[model samples]
Each structure stands twice: as structure tokens, then as C-alpha cells.
Target: MGYCRSKDLDFAFKVFEEMALKGFKRNEVAYTPLIHGLCVARRVDEAMELFAKMKNDDNCYPTVRTYTVLIN
Candidate 1:
């Protein structure tokens, strides 16, 4: 989140990938900030891809905030 907040998306993406590699449960909480950061960085296509992946995850789903991020 600090990475995302700081707009350091390269490190942010590294951390995101690390979470999956380390077997951390990827949930909405995990996906949202990266989505937000990507959106902030004008990377909407990547953000949408991530959102699609999140939706495909059995344990993950979009929240109101997630939709809000996309719409904004």
C-alpha cells in the first residue's frame, strides 16, 4: 500500500507478485490498491485485467469500493 500510495508501481507490482509467489491468499483487500494504483497511473487496461483475475478467483470478489475505483 505504501508503494501504491507513493505511486511506485514497479515495486508495488513486485510486491503483488510476491504475495502470490509466497502463497498469500489474494483477496479483494490485496487487489484493490493495486487496481487503484494502476488506475492512478492511467493503466486502466492492466487494472481491468487485474480486476478480471480477481473476479475469477473463487475467494475474491469486487466490493463497492472496487467498482468505485473503476468508475472513477
Candidate 2:
């Protein structure tokens, strides 16, 4: 999230991937920041893709904030 806030998306994505590889249970908390960062970076397509992935995950779902981020 610090990475995202700093606009260091490459590192942010690296950390995101690492979380998965390390068996972290990625939830909305994990996905939202990346989505927000992507949106901030004008990478809406990638953000949407990530959002789709989050939606498909059995244990994860978009929150109101998630939708709000994307919509904004």
C-alpha cells in the first residue's frame, strides 16, 4: 500500500505477487490498493482485470469502497 501510495506500481505489483507466492490469503484488503493505484496511474484496464480476478476468487469480493475506487 505504501508502494501504491508512492506510485511505485512495479514494486507494488511485485509485492502483490509475492503475497500470493508466500501463501498470503489475499482478500479485498489486498486487491483494493492495487486497483486504486492502477486507477491513479491511469491503468484502468489492468485495474479492471485485477478487479475481475478479485471477483472470481472464492474467498474475496469487492467492497463498496472497491467499486467506489473504480468508479472514481
The number of the candidate with the highest lDDT is 2
Best by TM-score: 2
lDDT of 2 at 30: 88
- Can you tell me which runs of candidate 1 are displaced by over 4 Å? none
Clashing pairs in 2: none
Candidate 2 has its poorest 10 consecutive residues by lDDT at 19-28
Ten contiguous residues minimizing lDDT sum, candidate 1: 23-32
Give the Cα lDDT of each candidate: 0.93, 0.95
Question: Residues 1-72, candidate 1, lDDT per residue (tens digit)?
Answer: 799999999998898899889999888888999999999999999999999999998789899999999999
The TM-scores of all predictions, comma-separated, are 0.94, 0.96
| Candidate 2 RMSD to the correct structure | 0.6
Q: Any idea what lDDT model 2 has?
A: 0.95
Instruction: In model 1, state the lDDT of residue 11.
Output: 96
> Which lDDT tens digits does candidate 2 get at residues 23-46?
898999889999999999999999
